[model samples]
Target: MLPLSDASVLVRRGDVPSTVLDDDLVMLDPLTGQYFSLNPVAAALWARLERPVPVGTLIAGLLEAYDGDPAIIAGETRAALTRLVDLGLLLVQPEQAE
Candidate 1:
């Protein structure tokens, strides 16, 4: 699993295509011709991932928008991100020098 620091940036690969239907997100990986279905929370995350997003920012946004224990929300968010990365659906960029 990728060790995602708070500053790690996540970006969706440009070639992947996805659509939302009845609260679920269906994504196709063109290269592998594999399809992935994501739940409502992940669909929402996908929308926010249109642009590069920092992990910390993602967690904070989820906390503000959803009702859940902070720790659980953060843990789930991280796990979801790791799965997306492992599946080659998302890319993780190391913290940029500033």
Candidate 2:
């Protein structure tokens, strides 16, 4: 399953229609026709959308980018990921053998 912090996806609008801008690490939902920007950390996480990463890994990445307490970063990352799930931007992946 995708980590809670790595749950959200980024999307943007297109001339023809909404499309998943994977190259740009963004996705556009046709229904909303709105653009969403993924923060640097989120953008990095989004780049690995195809692969499901663990919560600890995501937090570690963020911790590298921002100097702060690991616990606080972990909590915030989880909350951000949860918000993305609520927005229908992220999907939970079924666990698989590594």
Candidate 3:
């Protein structure tokens, strides 16, 4: 498991298959035959994973788009990202060299 940090980059695991509904997203791990669904917020996050992104960038974007307590938003986003990682729907990698 990777530690959740502002510097770490997150990306969707390329092998997982995903579907998008009106405001929801579902991912299926064909190998494991496990399906996971994301709420609207998580769906938005998932949509952002078309390419790798830094954790801090994700939080900053959310903060700019939504009205909420910064700390609460950070904690919930972190937790959501962690769960996505654990579920094999997402992967964490070292920040890319650019």
Q: For each candidate in the order shown, give its overall lDDT on alpha carbons.
A: 0.91, 0.57, 0.87
The segments of candidate 2 whose C-alpha lies over 4 angstroms from its true place after superposition are 1-27, 96-98
Q: Which ten residues in a row have the lowest lDDT in candidate 2?
A: 10-19
TM-score of each: 0.94, 0.56, 0.88
Clashing pairs in model 2, backbone N/Cα/C closer than 3 A: 10-27, 11-27, 12-27
Model 2 per-residue lDDT tens digits across residues 1-98: 34443333333112322234644445555456756666666666555444556656666677888888888888877776666666666565544455
Candidate 3 structure quality by residue, lDDT tens digits, 1-98? 75698988999888887888777788889879988888888888888887999999999999998899999999999999998888878888866677
Query: Candidate 2 lDDT (Cα, whole model)?
Result: 0.57
Candidate 1's residue-wise lDDT over 1-98, tens digit each?
64888899999888998888788999999989999999999999888888999999999999999998999999999999999999888998777899
Ranking of candidates on TM-score, top first: 1, 3, 2
Worst 10 residues of 1 by lDDT: 1-10
